[model samples]
Target: MGLDFVTVLFDSPFAVMNTIGLIAFALVGSAKAIREEFDLFGITVVGLAMAFAGGATRDLLVNRVPLVLQSPVEVSLGLLGVGLAVALSVVLRSPENHPITLVADAIGLAAFTTAGAIVATEATVSVFGVVVIGTINAVGGGAFADILLDRSPFILFDDFYASCAVLGGSAYWIMGSVGATGSTAAGVCAAVTVVARLVAVTYSWNLPTVQTLGVLSERMDDQ
Candidate 1:
């Protein structure tokens, strides 16, 4: 049998954005695994899951093939990301104290949300659709990780998670409506999301939930 192999680099603007998000997520996932006292193998798994899950989910939702699965370069980069996370975790040995994980998560959320907005624009989706896609792209990986860890999803329980994504997507949609596209639109989108997320984290801002929700949740707990 004969086989042909070719490289699939994350060379385009969209691909590059997605790759950036992937690496950022890997860092966050690695830190989280370390905080959980996981071994290297567990770290690798969590890192890859956090890295690729969001983008894969976004692609699947858009009816496109997942980039990591189809791209050798992306897969290699993903592995490199995992390896880097492992090295960093071992070196730091105190992941909980470092804020880099939250920073990475914010960056990843912004990048993925912006990329999804761009994809939605190219697909001629509605503004609401763009927000939905972007939000999903931003939080899908983190949500998956939380589910695996048996925790409440970040977007559902924490600081302005999906709101940042929605705002980012709305910015892009408005820019496109005003005849803006390309890097400028992407920059505005990502900036809004990242700034919002970082500020929310810094200030400990959270969405308003029923006070009884927490009480109910605690009461439902096995403990």
Candidate 2:
């Protein structure tokens, strides 16, 4: 079902490979977010939440069945990813690899954004709706993870985090309309999104900070 939707834009072996690659990227990101070892229940919760949190929310809002819930493959892969991340962190105990965390996150965000586009298009949603859903599916997990860890969401403070997802999703939607295959279009969009995000990070490009919010917060506090 997921592939069927993506096939509208990404139709090919390359796209299929890209889809799997992106999911793996997401798993690695979630694993990096896990800072410490825990019991089975704890690990399970983290893995499951990291993997399905975004897709589940996206499906609910869009009035569709959640893909992660319906597919055991996603769940299994998520668990494996989280487990490997934790194990590697424990073994390496080095700061050098910390940078890889951000890379993993960006890859995950890009891939999932494409997936969301595929799904939304399949559902016959509007373009705007596709963008919204795609963005949510891509970054929702990282956002929730940040909240759980008492940190600001990546999209709110990082270099073109959510912006990349938005662009990727929009591109996929456009490609689909042109009669591209699901995997091919999604692959291209995801790749572009990842590159764009990486460049933004490397060059420290960022949106202007909101100045009014600071003043507004001060006045509200005084009241």
Candidate 3:
């Protein structure tokens, strides 16, 4: 990826927005987890881990250095989010207020999905690669957050999160293919992801899981 400073600066505004969103999401998740079981230090670890875990892994997969390493702003926003989470833990005494968590996750997913597409476009990546990176960036944090909380992946159970991210990233790649500018593409992608995720959640749209009995019947039919 031959990204210059100018492009990384101007063409990647979505990256900044997405990075901030991730920080907030990580913090909320971490704070909730801390309030449930962990202490202050553990909260910090979970917050940082969830905040940067996915994008860091994505960068390594794409053979690029992590953005948080190069930008102090990323650290600042992430830490601020974590701090807010810790503070919130002091008052909100119940997990029943999960709406806050949902909102944070949605914002973070939108930002990361857009950022992933932007980065893929800058790298002149294929459509599939763009979608892959975008989806990963969008849901990576949630996956890590759930694991830290000792829960199964959220994407597998609810919210249609990964599908929305993949669709949004696909939209970004399509728009870029038509020669759209970076900022415009990012905005479009973010909007699509946010809308899709909200609609899916609102309507409880999700795929049905297949059980083992159904699988055995299909296999017998094939035989």
Candidate 4:
């Protein structure tokens, strides 16, 4: 069974969620790469970067090898991401705001944020650390890819993006404190995140921002 395979492949809920997040993030990366006119190899590299950059940064900050380097299966997943990137680049005409891209990004955000909360808990971190790690896990990969493409990081501009992850992480931690097991807690937290994200997307909810651009000013100012 699919569930059985998941439980067997991963000894814990975090591992399962992390793996799924990796694949989803990889797809998001590839979509961005295609949009940016990256070559095939570039797409693959971006896929790998988007899939692992955040977790890698988190691990290094904690003084550990990036899981992508330590886990062979994760490397395999990265390659699978590259292969999928190539296929998707051919099939997807519009990478930005495509249903597939939005769904993949939402799934990745849910899975990684919940799993990152679990990791922070296991590491005996503070509540701040839990939220911080979860948010980073959800956005770090995409942020890296955005940097390479010379785009503003979504986490900075997209109000609901990191908010959902933080709420999910907090939910996961609170559920754990209330005697929920890892899988059940993770599920609840991820569900919360996904629902919130989808609702935000549907409603176009956004935090207020000042309109400003250096060279693209609508009203030219006299010096």
Candidate 5:
């Protein structure tokens, strides 16, 4: 089963994206735990949670066993990411907030968003389901990790993050509806998500809050 899973990872683009997402998210989560000064066990737990939470939720929504539970290789990949985070910390101070880690987070988001869209589509869910699942799969792990860290989910009040997944998922649904091949749709979804996230990060873009909008409206009225 392990060998077969590895073969799938090599042969299937979807699986490849899943692998990348797992590793990257694990690293991101582990880094955060390290920043918070978690013990080694806690760090490993957080890393595994970040790597598997979103995918597990997606699988449950689609009525299947979570892939993480089905494969030891998945756990190994996640641990490899955790190991990478530890190594990076030893080499670089505050590696969690480093540019490379941020980039990895964006890539992981894109990969998971694409994976979720593909899985939801295969399950023949509605357009809404596809978008929602994609967004959740992209951000759910981070949210969960935040909770474990005793903080609110950053996505609920944070920068332009989950929206990228929504846009990417919509792109996938539109392209698929128009008869594009699965690969084409997945490619567009991943590209859209990654580009949007990187741009948002580079520019410090964020969605406006209600208070900010109200202030803007008041200024316009005064003008």
Candidate 6:
């Protein structure tokens, strides 16, 4: 069974996307830690947390052992990302906010979103479940990292982020509903997520709050 799983892992689109997400999110997390002047141990912890938290949560939801607990490769990939962030910090003044980091975050978001959608589909979950799981998988890690950094989870108040994952998951479900192959659906999902996230970053797009929409002011006037 282990051999068969290994073979499938090598051949699976899920594996590829998972690898990208692990590395990219680890780098982003490590970069943020470095910017915060965290010690090496703290940086490593944050990086691994960002890489594994979401996947672990997803696995728990599906009643499976977390892959990070079973695979040394997963930890190794996360460490590699941390090393890359450290190296970048040696050269770049602010690696956390660098364009490379921004792009990596977008790619990571897309990869994890697609991976989550694929896993949720395999679990025979409802379409709503797929979107919920996908969005959580994409943003859960970053939220965890933020908490470690002593900040509120940026997903709650940050610019358009989790919505990209929602859009990607919706696309994945729609494509599958239309009889698309799993690979095709996964590709479309990742593409949609990455593009949406990148555009949001580029344009500084943000979802409006109730205050921004004047709902509070209107209610006050009515009272």
**lDDT tens digits by residue: candidate 2, 1-223:** 8777656335553345334533555455445355544455665565556556777878887797876777666665676666656665676664124666667767777777876777777778888999998888888777776665567776787848889988888888888789998767877788878898888878988776668678788899999
Candidate 1 on 1-223: residue-level lDDT in tens? 1122221234465766777887888778767777887778887788888878877887887889987788776666667767766777767767645686678788999999988888877877777988888888888888887776667886777759888999999998888789885788888999999999999989988766787688878888947
lDDT scores in order: 0.80, 0.69, 0.76, 0.82, 0.92, 0.92
Give Cα distance to truth, residue 168, candidate 4, Å: 0.6
Worst 10 residues of 3 by lDDT: 1-10
Instruction: Return the candidate ranking by TM-score, descending.
Output: 5, 6, 4, 1, 3, 2
Q: How far is each candidate from the true structure, as Cα RMSD in Å?
A: 6.8, 6.2, 5.4, 5.3, 1.8, 3.5
**Which of 3 and 5 is ahead in lDDT?**
5
lDDT head-to-head 3 vs 4, winner: 4
Off by over 4 Å in 4: 1-8, 209-223
Compared with the true structure, model 1 gives a TM-score of: 0.85
Clashing pairs in 1: none
Alpha-carbon error at 84 in model 6, in Å?
Answer: 0.7
Clash totals, every prediction? 0, 15, 0, 0, 0, 0
Error of 6 at 168 (Å): 0.5
lDDT of 5 at 89: 92
Q: Residue 99 CA error for candidate 3 (Å)?
A: 1.9
How well is each residue in 44-63 modelled by candidate 5, as lDDT tens digits? 99999998999999999999
lDDT value, candidate 6, whole model: 0.92
Cα lDDT tens digits, model 6, 1-223, are 8787666555787997898999999999999999999999999999889988999999888889998999888888899999999999999999999999999999999999999999999998888999998988899999999999998999877668999999999999999999999999999999999999999998988887877679878988899
How well does each candidate superpose onto the true structure, as a TM-score?
A: 0.85, 0.77, 0.83, 0.87, 0.95, 0.92
**In model 5, what lDDT does residue 97 have?**
96
> How accurate locally is residue 157 in candidate 4, as Cα lDDT from 0 to 100?
76
For residues 1-223, could you state the per-residue lDDT of candidate 3 as single tens digits? 4466435544456656555566766666676677668877777777877788778877877888998898886777678778877776677775325567666767778888887776766677677889988888778877887787788977887748899998899888888779998777888888898888878877889776667678888999999
Candidate 2 runs further than 4 Å off: 1-33, 36-40, 94-97, 212-223
Clashes of 4: 0
Q: Model 1: how far is 48 from its true place, Å?
A: 1.1
Error of 1 at 157 (Å): 1.3
